[model samples]
Target: MEWLVLLLIGLVGGTIGSLVGLGGGIIVVPALLFFSTYTVILNDISPQVAVGTSLLVIVFTGLSSTLMYMKHKKVDYKSGFLFFIGSGPGGVVGAYVNSYLKVDSFSVYFGIFVILTSIILMFREKLKRKEKVNHFPFQRVYTDGEGTTYTYGFRPITAVIISFIVGFSSGLFGIGGGSLMVPAMILLFGFPAHVAVATSMFMIFLSSILSSVTHMTMGNIDWELALFLVPGAWVGGQMGAWLNTRLKSKTVIHLFRMVLIIVGFRLIYEGLAQ
Candidate 1:
């Protein structure tokens, strides 16, 4: 039953993460911490272990989703690599920082982060992008499945700096960092929605690799639990990428925002009570 629950958690996390480029870690990490702390099913799940395991799982989730998105030609490979420049090192730094946090403090900070992410998603659509002339060094033109062309660009240094922050959050919290990156790509850098999501997943893949490696060296991963989670996450990643083409994600996004808020408050309460 515990194994089954873990699988389900992976499935749900991967699907939503892939669908929105949030990287399923947001779901997986909290679920692990909650179950381990509140129930007998999971035992002794420290924040470091939960985060490390989540990052490991996100590697597969990102890989699976990126592969699916690739078929649609939405991923911006060049930009993804550029972003990785900062994110990779930042992930290492974040992983080191994670070691210093206690359970209660981790819970409170993570809860706050989750709430902030929810707020970002909630208002992202309403936030208007300022019109500006494109003079950035890196320019990209993308054509979606519907044959609509979108042009976007960003300064290479700026993108790397942003991705570094995103990567740091991922390392610290075991999230995919797409929650932050996707929004920045769309609102700040003028990336098309699909392109932003796909590219963000690519960056997640790369950053997760570096973060997971750091976690591994710290001996924070639970290989037994990770075994159960990876398969579901893989399947869910594919499912999400497929659904992205067929479904209107507005409803899903709304539902996800509510879930984040609920989870965020619960975590905060738990930390305070502890």
Candidate 2:
């Protein structure tokens, strides 16, 4: 039963994470903490363990989604690699910080972060788009499947600084840096939504590698639970990538925002009550 729950969590996390470019750790980390605390099924799950395990699962989820996005030509490889330059080292730093958080404090902080992310999603569409800067050193022109061309660019140093913050959040919370990165790409960097999602997953894959290694050295991972979670996350990533091609995501986004709100409040309440 515990294994079954873990599988479902991975599947749901992967699908939503891939579809939205949030790196599925948002779902996995919370679910692990909730189940371990509120039920008899999963026992002895510390926040550190949950975060480490989630990051490991994100590695597979990001890989599976990235491969699918690559075939679709949605991923911007150059930008993804560039973002990784900052995110990799930032992730290591974040992982080290995670060791200092206690369960109640972790829950409260994570809840607040999740709620803020959902709010960002809510207001993102209404936000004024950034004007294109033609003189930036990292200019990109992307053509999607429908032949719609998008021109977006950012200074390499600016991008690196932003990505470092995103990676730090991912390492500290294990929620996949994409939650922050996707919005930054769209609002700050002028990336098309699909392109942002794809590239964010690519960055998540790379950053997760560094963060997970840090967690591994800290002995925070649960190998048995990760074994169950990873396969489901991998399959779900493929499913999500396929769905992103077919679905209109507005409705999905609306539903997901509600879920995030509920989960965020619950986590906050749990932390305060404890």
Candidate 3:
């Protein structure tokens, strides 16, 4: 029964998360933290362990989603690589820092982060404006496997700074960092929605690998439950990626925003109650 619940958590979390490049960590972490049976079943359950397990699960979820995106050729390797360079080290730092914080403190901060992210996502469309980028360092033109072309420019230095911050937050909070990356890519760096989603997945793949490894060393992961969760995440990730190819960019953003809002409220409630 416990295993069954874990599987379901992974499935739902992976589907929604992969669709928006969130990597399902938001879903998994909260579920583990609040589920009625979570602490009951796992005697050693802590917020840090919950977060660590989520990160480990994201490793497979990100891989599955990335492969699916690769098939569609939506990945922007150059930007993805730049994001990874900064995020990798940041993830290590965040994971280590987690050892110093209490669960309640982390919960409050996580709630705040979720709420802020939701607000930004909600207002992003209304804030969209035409801006000219004349001197960004990284410029790219690429065609996806579906023959859709995207042209965009971004500053490498800016991307690295943001990616590092995103990585740090992801490692500290046990998220995939996609919640931050997707919005930054679109709103801050002027990336197309689909490209942002795809590239975010690639970045998540890189940073989560490092974060999960750090968590492993800290004894903060639950391997027994991860065994149940990973399968569901893998299957759901592929499904979500496939659905992404068929949806319009606006629809994807709307869905992503809705998820964030709902999750954010729940997180806030949990933090206050604690």
lDDT of 1 by residue, 46-137 (tens): 99999999999999999999999999888899999999999999899999999999999999999999999999988876755423528877
Question: Looking at model 1, which ten-residue stretch has the lowest summed lDDT?
Answer: 124-133
TM-score of 3: 0.90
Global fold similarity of model 1 (TM-score)? 0.97
lDDT of 3 by residue, 1-274 (tens): 7889899999987887788788888889878877743467545568789889999999899899999999888889888999999899989999999888776677777878877876766766564422454567777776666676666778888889999998998898888888788878877676777778888988898899999999999999989989999999999889889888997546766776676677777667766776
lDDT of 2 by residue, 1-274 (tens): 8789999999999999999899999999999998888799998799999999999999999999999999998999999999999999999999999999999999999999999989988986565546666877788998877788788999999999999999999999998888789888988888988889999999999999999999999998999999999989999899988888778677878999999999999989988988
Candidate 1: where is the Cα deviation over 4 Å? Answer: 127-133
Model 2 alpha-carbon drift over 4 Å, by segment: 127-131
lDDT ranking, best first:
1, 2, 3
Q: What lDDT would candidate 2 get against the real structure?
A: 0.92
Clashing pairs in 2: none
Write down the TM-score of every candidate.
Answer: 0.97, 0.97, 0.90
lDDT of each: 0.92, 0.92, 0.82
Which of the two candidates, 2 or 3, achieves a greater TM-score against the reference?
2
Residue 73 in candidate 3, Cα distance off native in Å:
0.5
